[model samples]
Target: MSFIALHPLRTFSDTWRHRYLLAQLIKRDVLLRYRGAVFGVLWIFLSPLFMLAVFAFVFGNIFQSRWPEQTGGMPFWLLLYCGLIAFNIFAETVSRAPTSVRGYPSFVKKIIFPVHILPVVPVGVALVHGTFNFLVLLAALSWSGNFHAHALLFPLLLLPLLLLALGISWFVAAWGVYIKDMTQIVPMLVQMLMFVSPVFYPASAVPAALRPFYDYNPLGTVIESTRSAVTGQSIDWRAWGVALGFCMAACMLGYAFFQHSRDEFADAL
Candidate 1:
């Protein structure tokens, strides 16, 4: 009897069976980030700490802005650090997504690879750095005497930001293969988002008329909710619900876009 060829479904099953390759690729991405750095992985922890110091020095002291009172005794630095951690994860994941697929042309050209897994590498690397940053935030808050029981909920609050990043990453990574300019554009967009999102200043500082804009942006609400969770403060559940809904929609749309464009990647590369 003639042997039957494997069906398309079996090809997908074979790809799923290669999940270990994806894990190794993610590990490689993480290690390659610090390959030549003197401090290696230590740089992950120190970079954000140094960032907080500069921000605190400039905004906390240079401008002498009064820290808002709603943080329930949490130091302004701690409040800023909480928001910083969440924003860093979002920024790092989205910024690097463009390069994730673009950087590995060999895999696309030569190997029988599952390209969809490519965008995941940056998110995995960012999560590793984020875990370290979270530990550092914990230590800082504990030292500042602002560590609350709610700090344990910080991970839960960050889920929305992670979802947002994943969605943006998939969309950017796919487009990056087609258009080279995304590499430059994504970072600039993230910088704009940082300023727009409540990283250096609280949403409370924004005028009421302008508050609606911040409420609608997923990044702002995620950052604010993350800060509140870490410090045992209250959050606007209505805004959060709206932001989370957008995040879920982004994730679905991004996945759809990525899957549709994925077949074109090898040709684009």
Candidate 2:
């Protein structure tokens, strides 16, 4: 009997059919994060809220430094909140991706599973947290009377960030199986990347010559654009278009690299 080989699309379809398994995996991942916390799942909403309050109180009131180019007359706190939403997702995904597959060695050895989707669990959990954070931002903005019509563009602006996270996760997750050091390295790198990506500061903070780098950097573009969307500030459409193209290309390249390296995972592990 001649056998047919399943294409990647076919493999994805087969994987999608196992939605129940995916859901169970996602739930376990989500719950595990809060297992030892005091408030448990409430931390999902509370953590960011607490952080935002601290920033608003410290930077907005105590220091009283007016951040340049305030968006729609929004407080610096609200502007930071807008950028933090997208930054948090990328941070969560990149920090967690390295451990995603390694943490589930048994799944690789014992179960017949679509192992490729394993890297996505962290991203899924992060997105859930980000959704909560977004709600909190909306409430804060509305309370402050800065919730502008441009807020509708926030999600569309974040699409590049989501893609970039997915791409980097695939790469890091694949490398993680081979090098145990990735667990330590990735989180530190993500922290550094966070500062460099314009989360807590504006791209304008960069020097004029360095501005091009910030404009073209995929992570920086998303952060700035998402902030713009929420603040009714005009977006640098050209920079954002460049970021979109870079993210899409990176995603394709990362997936190809991941698939190429996937076969070696079991042996490396």
Candidate 2 local lDDT, residue 249: 64
Which is the leading candidate under lDDT? 2
For model 1, residues 210-243, the per-residue Cα lDDT tens digits are: 9988867888888888887786888677878878
Per-residue C-alpha lDDT of model 2 across residues 34-118, encoded as one tens digit per residue: 9998899999889889988998898788987555664438788788778888998999988999988898887766546777788
Native-vs-model 1 lDDT? 0.78
lDDT, model 2, position 11: 35
| Superposed model 2: Cα runs more than 4 Å off | 1-19, 36-38, 69-72
Give the C-alpha miss distance for residue 233 in model 1, angstroms.
Answer: 1.2
| Worst ten in a row by lDDT for model 2 | 1-10
**C-alpha root-mean-square deviation, candidate 2:** 3.6
